[model samples]
Target: MADLPNCPICTMPDPLLAADGYECATCGHEWLAAPDDGLDDIRDANGNLLADGDAVSIIKDLKTDGKAGGIKVGTKIKSIRLVPGDHEIEARVDGRQLLIRAAFVKKA
Candidate 1:
């Protein structure tokens, strides 16, 4: 339905409206619309809903610019900005701006 929004957790386009809230078929996470803005919650890897300025940590070592020295596991990334794409996480690491996949990080 046009009125119903996409699931914030899995980004599923269609979610069923239950008595309590909207239930996502993809991830099965139920969410209620925010009373103020009507936007659903966006969850991080740890099932914690993420917001701007939230701190997250890398789950694994990630290569950058084809370098052998990559971002280490458990690297703490701060003040992350959540974009529209499922894996898009914009943040600055070591004074360099980069885009990190959401699946590789957890809320810190």
Candidate 2:
């Protein structure tokens, strides 16, 4: 199949697949991977650093009067994705997974 195939790692030229990942022929460094669409970072309510796409717990009980209402403390959120904002995470809890400001939710 003749096509413009760039290195999966560096998005540059493709090398002979070394061990697992593709190595950049020019840089001499192996590029690891591309993050998944769901892969992202999230912070906790106390403002602590959390991992990208992690399950976190709500330390403080949250009261929402919107479409999705009320998340209690110690609630666990799964597959939380981080975005760039004052509130960094997009997550779901209870009946609705919603965008949560990282300053509000902490890493479980």
Whole-model lDDT values for every prediction:
0.81, 0.67
* lDDT for each residue of candidate 2 in 1-108, tens digit (9 for 90 to 100): 434346654677655455655566766666554446543544466766777678888777777768555887778888887766665677766667677777766667
Q: Per-residue lDDT for 14-105 in model 1, tens only?
A: 88888867898878889886455322576767788778898999998899995458899999998998766555688999878888877788
> What local lDDT score does residue 60 receive in model 1, on the 0 to 100 scale?
89
Candidate number achieving the greatest TM-score relative to the actual structure: 1
Q: Which stretches of candidate 2 lie over 4 Å from their true place?
A: 1-47, 67-69
TM-score, per-candidate, Cα-based? 0.57, 0.52
